[model samples]
Target: MPGLYHICYLSVAKLSALQPTPELGFEAIKEKTRKANSAAGLTGCIIFTGQHFLQVIEGIQEDVEDTFGRISRDTRHTDVRVLSEGPIEVRDFPEMAVNCGGDETLTAEALAEISAVLDYPQHQLHIREIRTLLSVLTQPSRKQDALLAG
Candidate 1:
């Protein structure tokens, strides 16, 4: 049962100015990430706060690790620090290979929630808490279902 579950990780990185505009660069990055993640059977959400990127990825152990490996090497990400990683019984993001686009309010809420979870020392985090945090951050509201709950 444990092996059948998905591996999830939270990471934060500085955004790089690789395109003419941050929005343009983010779109390109997200497009590439979505396609690659779908091919790898991965699922997750990424929240960009203009200055930084916070993301969570979930998939089979090897697939998740491999995806992270590629992401870590990408020039667009810097100071990538994984906040937490482990196996989970359920996927926090079951529908999307990658979820990135949203208004600034959504981004702010997600970042604040993530910050609250990370406020605990890494070693102090429990698997259940991690799962809960991911669920809370990634779950789309009823109104957003039409747009993000694919």
Candidate 2:
């Protein structure tokens, strides 16, 4: 009951909120989440790609569950689906309360493929894949930087 637990989920962003710039309203949300999560002793990361959000939250069982519940009710997200959740021996992100990543966006089709993989009966085996994908996607891309600078 009282142990370190983690939950990962994927959700579509409310199109309207994305607005003129997806970061405009979402930056505030991210800051609020970071502060609240820090206060609750939680650590995790959120990856947003203009359309979808993939997040991993880890902490005390109750705290992680409560945060997920609150996020499910948040108006900014839609089609919320838990990708994976269970007790973890250690945290993947121990230092950051919340890390937001969107350097490389995932296509809708790719997201669907990932969701399918994690939804299968042998989903556990693929857990690390998703985490690794998140880690790679989170990294800032020099190619993107160059394009932006050009």
Q: By TM-score, how accurate is candidate 2?
A: 0.74
- Number of the top candidate by TM-score? 2
Candidate 2 minimal-lDDT segment of 10 residues: 141-150
lDDT of 1: 0.65
| Candidate 2 local Cα displacement, residue 76, angstroms | 0.9
Best candidate according to lDDT: 2
Q: Model 1: runs farther than 4 Å from truth?
A: 1-16, 104-134, 142-150
Q: Model 2, 7-62: lDDT tens per residue?
A: 99888889686646676767777889899999999998887666677799999999
